[model samples]
Target chain A: MSPSSPSFAVEFDEINQEIVLRGTMRVRSPEEMTDATDLIRRSFGHGGHLVYVNIKRLTHLNMTAFRCIADVLTEACLADPQRRIVIVASSVIAWSAPLFETLASAQPNLSVEIYDSAFYPGQTFVEDESFIPILRTQTKMTWRHEREILPRHGMKEGMAIADICCGIGDFATLIKRQFNPTRLIALDHSKKSLEYARRVAAEFGLNSIEYTYGDASQMLLADNQFDFVTCRHSLQIFDRPDILLRELYRICKPGGRVYITNEKNSHCLGEPHSESIRWTYDEVAKLFSHFDMDVEMGPKSRRLLTDAGFDTIKVESFMVTNLDGDPRDFADVIEAWENVYAGQMAVRRGDSPDFIRRFRQGFKDHVLAALHPKGYAGWPIWAASGRKPF
Target chain B: MIERQVSPEPGAFEQMASLTLDTALFRSEFHLCDRVSEYLADIVAQSHEDPARYANFSSQLINEMIEFSFRSAVPTGQIDFRLLKNEERVRVSIEFAPVSDHQPDWLANDTSAIANGHPAVGDLWGLADAIRVNLHTEEHKENHVTLMADFALLEAVR
Candidate 1:
């Protein structure tokens, strides 16, 4: 929730085209971006552009809150390429500041410099900013036609289904509403996320969809109990994707269908990837095929499923497009690709500081080019399904 | 620089502790102590030159404390670690106040130096520069043990 009163102060230098933010900024607080947007509107006057943003005294900044701030700053700075942001952080924040430099570099327009202590004219300093507004827009994405994916699985009126590692149970809730499943189990490792899923399920007045805390490596549930099982956009990130696939097979009844879907490799705009994202699907298929369940990576990965011994298998790809130029829809697509995908990859990869600077610059240019006048953007989901032999 | 108090009153059981980390709420019975020790090692080493080499000593002290407490089945143990900046030293004290009719048998006869008693006998003796134990047997049957270790700045440790 927002503070009863602002914990921040903004001083705009209209003559010099500068905005100096003073005081504490609780980054993830409910009204963080709202306050920033107000400040930006008031300061930038026309295009949210500033010659400088002096965040030298904004104490109590953290990585979690930094993410919330960075998203906002990236978009705002995109307004003018020549703008600059300078952050003067205390020694306490030195360890995390250089990485913050990496994030600020994500903005193609803005030039950034950071200093562990306040910079004198001859010395140097860096930039940071905004994510809450983006979070609000992303959650309200355009709905998908589940029939484009579900009926192919023979989902009938009373069949059982499971979504493992179901983050917040978005897909599970959608399937429950569309397919009228008699029983559904939503499992994830995070108890906090599961609690949110339960609350969402209750809000929709959904019963019979049980929420359980479980690990992907070992689901502490009965084997061969589910008629259909699914895990989406999760395998590649697992420490052991192979073990997780086998676990999926262990819980599927004979003749029941199970599918795993992961994104195409080189996710940043170089398409025409192979069936295997990190490893050959044939190898994955061959290794786990012994478990008595047929496996496939995605719809495009037919050869691997056939090689794995599934005589009959189905494959399909669905393109998700924006809805009617809604700013929120465009923002949602931008959020997924920019913040969720590219941003995380940058942090995790641990690239050299200069390399990060160049990479973030290039990434921003690439994404801004892809985004449309109306925020029009689209991506495809490749899904392949195979039934365990009867 | 933080002075954290975990639970109960300060004078409740006579605690001269500076920072108290409360693991009472979380169940790290399987690995909590290990994680705390690991984290402490990182913080304790920040000012030292051979931080990595001199690391894990704090972990050793905490591990023994956890072992002794869990063995005695003491409920809700508290960890208080203090920084003696003037002396360039750190002290970690683990206490389980009013541990019922008796304390852990190994601890009752244990030395303030704490050597050759429990299975993890070598940890404290090998790591700590000094060790001491204080048992509050008057009102609360409390067992508080403290370990003081000298860590060098880049010059001193080297």
Candidate 2:
């Protein structure tokens, strides 16, 4: 194995409990594939305890190599039904965990978990006036859309609505257009974003949507005034989400719904190994636990509303995909992301510029050349909504 | 300011692929051309391995079209612009309906027919792989025109 070839490098742990596979591995022929299988079997080493195959150190992960590794582990599990295989992959990789999970779904002893090496989600330069539209386009959203997260939450024709931390007011305007809320107040603390939102709304000749500037944790709006309260993709920015949630609950009228959607893949996908903003469902549950909320949910929907003391909670997921192409449209989106990523990294104080530049280029190449043709290029948008007690 | 009623909703022109310049003759001036040209150059620079040649023509094409719109007989409501990717080249297409019945003579004939007399018009042939223009007098008030200029994308630009 060439030390710096970036194709395949294997390092076995002295304890023999774990094996770290690094770099992009491709099997050119069946012989090479068989060799990779033998190496993985060697790593298992007649083990009775759970064996870990760590792909977290891989610079550019190749799924083919991992599939081979998974096959070896499956045969091992057949030999010893109690032997467990833990595949530790970086949180940034889109397909690694899912692909492994699918492979392991059949076998009882195999599992995949995201290593907590994600970048810290921060108030990126996305707050800048110019960036809001490009970011929204990445998610295939407009100022207002007939198709939305609103009607699904039971928004009516003329009820009052408030969008907290509503950067650029895209979702708020969308709700107003789709549902015709009697009073649509779009609120955000950032002057730049609020101004942009106001200008956009004005451009649309929309006078009904009101723009207010205020922090989510300390909104000046009255309680029980809004029919619906929503905050999307901004929950991670608050120093304390618990305070914001309590405020969301306070302002929400009895039986009114509160919806919280986390942009999971956006925050975690392409996250670096050094930092983590990959808030797991458990982390989200723990974060809200301080406020005595319990939304231990499913893959797409978690019952955060139930934890927030709301009855009749429903969790829904929205995903935008089949965009551009594998390398073509995907490359463009990644480049658009690169436009904001450096500034976001700077905001988080995460990695050095050198490291970020390298990762950005490497990820583009990996996605373009090695990733599956119909791979995961989208973030899982999970929304949890529940009503206040009537 | 032009009465451009565009919401944050995705416009026909979105992202780096295209940008719409829907301003009145009084607003755009020479500054619009320079600013948009610079933006196009930046896009080409970022997208191409070697941007020097493609960037040059993109600026020239943008300037001439803005000149074409500015010199139109009447004020036009909107002139749409897009940079599209063809199989082998990038096509910069500009669509607008000028409020004039008299077709612009510059576009009436092949650019080379008057190349010597109008060097700026002559430069079009050198800068583009193909120049396709569609002009039809709309019965309402304006003459619809679509100018599509294809530039060399090479292996680098894609």
Candidate 3:
């Protein structure tokens, strides 16, 4: 009942046939648990069949809270037997949705719906409003990168290919269209991202591809299954990149190809913020070498491939122009770059927020200018392809 | 290495106890203790008012109390197989130490007593047995526990 207290607040609109429940429903507190239970009862009592849980402001719910909410929703659905519970939240909550969905699915009556607010207008940052278009542009650019590199490595139709960390299914769709591979497995850890990829592939009517959720380093696939393995802009996430690259090597058939693309270590661009960028690139390069895999570093990543135990490695670089004339696209890119810079600065400071604001702002400004048109708003994207020796 | 009897100071016990409580280094063990404590506390309070509830809860409370004490002394870390000299029973030691400067006073005192006890006569074999049971169930194949045992020794040097 206390407005300041952390408890679930429910509102039922009978005419609209909607039930909205908001607030932090964590089980760490008894009040929150009681409020959550009450919300479910009140919503169901009002003949409000369609339920919409707005979790935009609800932050920090533990596994216990998740279970409690899931149980209440499940019980309510069983009573009605035809009601659906819709969850609307930011894309940050996408990872947690699978856990909730799994819990809800335990009961036959309940159907869980998760809607990412980014796909909706006005909810996300003004700059991020154009994310779909930017993602589409990036997807297209990745395909172009793949096209230029794949054929150079002698990739052909009917070959078994694995696309590791296939974001938005861009490379998978591209390979399906270009090479028409015999069996293409597109694997990514993010199920929501994979869902988008799946829908896009389904729309394109591509059926040869299979999707799997897994870590690239410890793929569940059988050894020596893939003729070629392709990864784009995903090598940075691996805590042990060497292990993943070695696994990629093991999976490829003798004489099969491996194609990898990453944003070139910006030290080659001679940007003002290139020191940190160079360190990240060096760390990645070290991992590649540790695996005894050949690598081509710099504006051309073909050298990385050559050093990574590959006999023949080729490198190519291209620039993606964000010249859609939409200031929003430029702003989005700037925001993303700012986030990256902020994260780096935080890590350097051991996650302390005591640094001078002026210094941080100056770094942000330098990065934005270097990335924008005034200083050549183009990043050196590298593509390298190499053939594994028999 | 020479056999040494290190007498931990009173302040050391206080520090260890504070650390244990603050960091919950023995959270699993403490949770079992808490359950036993709560049940016993309720029964004791209720016995003053109503004896029937106390009588009904006594058996369960006793079992939980025994289990709790046993877990507190045993190492919850990785299980290593070893044969005790001339004995058919296997001897397993699961080592744990409070990582924080704050641990519960009673628990810390109990731990110190057990650690510094005479080699021939152990203070609490029942407590050690409970810990072994918990460790056997919880310890993974690659379990590793890095204890801050040197902290008190270093402080003594200072």
Candidate 4:
């Protein structure tokens, strides 16, 4: 195999009892995949009743490579019927689930599981169309700060840009109009969001931005393809922020910067009802934590990027105040947050009626503070960037 | 230069692009199959309803076809690759020049084996709606062996 062509890695995580097969493997013969077969055999040595074979990131595998893997898995299944081998595939990669299902048919002890929810716990909650208005309003408020802040973090006109996890693509359209990137690709996993994004782009007569659907953790986009990569308010939503950061680093050109924005919900404040707003926003952080998300990840961006092998780090905090734009827009965002957080998430977590009422009151009070002539409401966001080393 | 021609049938396959490379160079490295396949897949995928899914399927199919040719085609010639698409189907056609005397036997053997559902040519090729092995001696100045395969544009996940 050529060095520049797609490659594969088989890594066994003993702690997780999972063997992750990543990248592409297309070889002339089974002998070329001895290392992968050896890894699977070694994984069997570990004492575990259930071993997960994760092929979610394995983008390409020809029949020869597939046959080699299938043979190893079949042997493992036959050797120990007491143990089960689960082949985990991703729904985003269309070929994997069906292809692995064929192997499951022959081996009774082995089965194929399509992994969607495990990767993205908040997919259903965020993809709801009702959240569209709040998302647009949130962007409208953040863009005001980001447009001035972006240039400090290496954003300039005519540079290639990619907006990873760009929900509804409103931010990308704003970037296009402001920065005039030579190439702009806005990628999101949610099909509904991307559809809405495309329609909005068309209505606004912005045709240059390429809207793509893809998983943020394992993107099909080629390596070192973008000069500036921005993922806004997305790192906190993912269960594996590290995996998402690794991808952002991969797509960024050497010496180019990757900028990210995240929120610290507990830091949200309102003057007139500071006590109520503070209590509710703290609960908001706990609520997201229950779903495996980190709403307080804003302050941790620097450490995350540094550990991901980025240098020249720059971090700043911005507060979206009710006074920044029309106060009603800020109120609308707070109201929508109440519906999703109190009505949906809190209820799903089986909170009691009294707890829900208290939670709902906080949002209503924040909205009241936003509309009050003498009151101020603010939502804190951290914007940080680190340059990929040359 | 590689020539491109759309199917004459109304609403049938419209030619997308054609690439020509030295057969020896293509066969020398295994990765060329992926590079070429990915390039074509990227082009065709843009028009699909689900670009990511279609790109993955198209790349797999195209890579398999190229790999098959890498193993079977004559070593010294130009490999002409063409991509064509219509509303319902996408076609990938590869043509390579065979040494004059080898054309008849190759054309007969490939066409018959493929028609009889032979596995020697690779089972994944069966996914194609039709596989035509033809000798286009008149199109070029020499005997060119053309291998064309058509795949349906699946509405749902395949």
For each of the candidates, the C-alpha root-mean-square deviation to the true structure, in angstroms, is 22.0, 26.1, 24.7, 5.0
Top-down lDDT ranking:
4, 2, 3, 1
Best by TM-score: 4
Candidate no. 3 TM-score: 0.40
CA lDDT scores, all candidates in order: 0.46, 0.53, 0.47, 0.81
Better of 1 and 3 by DockQ: 1
* DockQ comparison, 1 vs 4, better candidate: 4
Candidate with maximal lDDT: 4
Candidate 3, residue A251: the lDDT equals: 74
* Model 2 per-residue lDDT tens digits across residues A1-390: 111122456766747577777544533223566766787787777444788877664533233344466567788878777788888865333234545675577788888877642211234344556567565554343122225556777777888788887877777766777778887777765657767777788898886676754446534344576778887766654445565777688778888988777644423232232122232222334433333333332233353455567778777665443333333444455455555543453224455767556545634532343234544444345677778887
lDDT of 1 by residue, A187-296 (tens): 76554456667777889998657776544544533457678887765554453456566666656667877765654432323112222221222322332233222333
Best by DockQ: 4
What are the models' TM-scores? 0.40, 0.41, 0.40, 0.83
Off by over 4 Å in 3: A1-137, A268-308, A321-331, A340-375, B1-158
Calculate DockQ per candidate and list them: 0.02, 0.01, 0.01, 0.27
Model 2 lDDT, residue B153, Cα: 51
Q: How close is candidate 4 to the true structure, as a TM-score?
A: 0.83
Interface RMSD of each: 20.8, 21.9, 23.8, 4.9
In candidate 3 the C-alpha lDDT for residue A85 amounts to: 62
